[model samples]
Target: PAARVVLVERSPEMAGFAHATLAHPGNAHLGDRASVLTADVMLTGKARGEAGLADNSFDFVIMNPPFNAAEDRATPDQLRKQAHVMEDGLFESWIRSAAAVAKPRGGLAVIARPEQLGALLDAIDGRFGDTEMLAVHPRPEAAAIRIVVRATLGARGKLSIRPPLMLHAETGNGPAERTEMINNGLASLFGD
Candidate 1:
């Protein structure tokens, strides 16, 4: 059987769009395996369960939470602002919710700006362990702009910083081969 997936979105419009996209003919194969849930992830576990998220049920939870600092320039568009701007303690709140829905020994993966690494690790400290980080660089010599973290719930392994994933080449040709492969779903950033 295909793995069941639930895409939780706070924005109703975005959730509707996701549902429609998943229901489209092009995604027919995935239509039956995935669902969209329009609900606030900040809700308490019981509240979330009432809203369609079963507690301690998901095998894994993957998220890309807004990481922009409040001091950053804000977008003029309300929707964009809501989606891209990070409010106070939002990161921790999201992590808490992710942990709530994850099963014992389940995994959690998060991608965010590199600056958020410290906060991210702090947020997941007790809830998820065996943390591993992968830096994502724009080019070979460039500093990492983003970091992808993977951790297992209820684990105790020491954190490991894996090799960096370069998105672009120094030659300015285009995306690196690994990036292309990942974008096409032909490869995973963390190998199986």
Candidate 2:
């Protein structure tokens, strides 16, 4: 199962990590099957022909887009502002970008704040359908903090909402194996 992986990062830091990971000698076996592209997909996604990203070329695309539009604060940190705050239709732009590269009858998945569910669906609009959603709660009976949605391109079937995924158990332990691995310094979401 060495499925080809294409990582597109808008942030320089993320892009660097992806590039290094793919290019590292440890992963040299992947060779041309993996790629890391740095671009602001929202603005230039349609014009990435030079990057060899052709239209409807991918079987599936997954995205985690910025959900906040905290524009009123006027923060001085331009990078943080650009990363968190959203201009009008920014979510739509990201969704459209993903749809443009997804193959027909393929799939798209997005993870975003539970509060942004409406916006997420609206962003995909008519581009994708047959939506399925899973709510992620921090604890049992807790309100959902995040939502994971998957949909098929060009399929307009009725939407289905699945059961929630509780991160913490009733004993208050979170993702047992992952937590243990992290505590042992054997696994991490961010690497050294």
lDDT of 2 by residue, 90-170 (tens): 778878877877899888988888878888889776989988888877777679888888888898986788766666676
Return the top candidate by TM-score.
1
TM-score of each: 0.94, 0.79
At residue 60, give the lDDT of candidate 2: 89
- lDDT for predicted candidate 2 compared with the true structure: 0.77
Lowest lDDT sum, 10 consecutive residues, model 2, at 183-192
Clashing pairs in 1: none
Candidate 1 segments exceeding 4 Å error: none
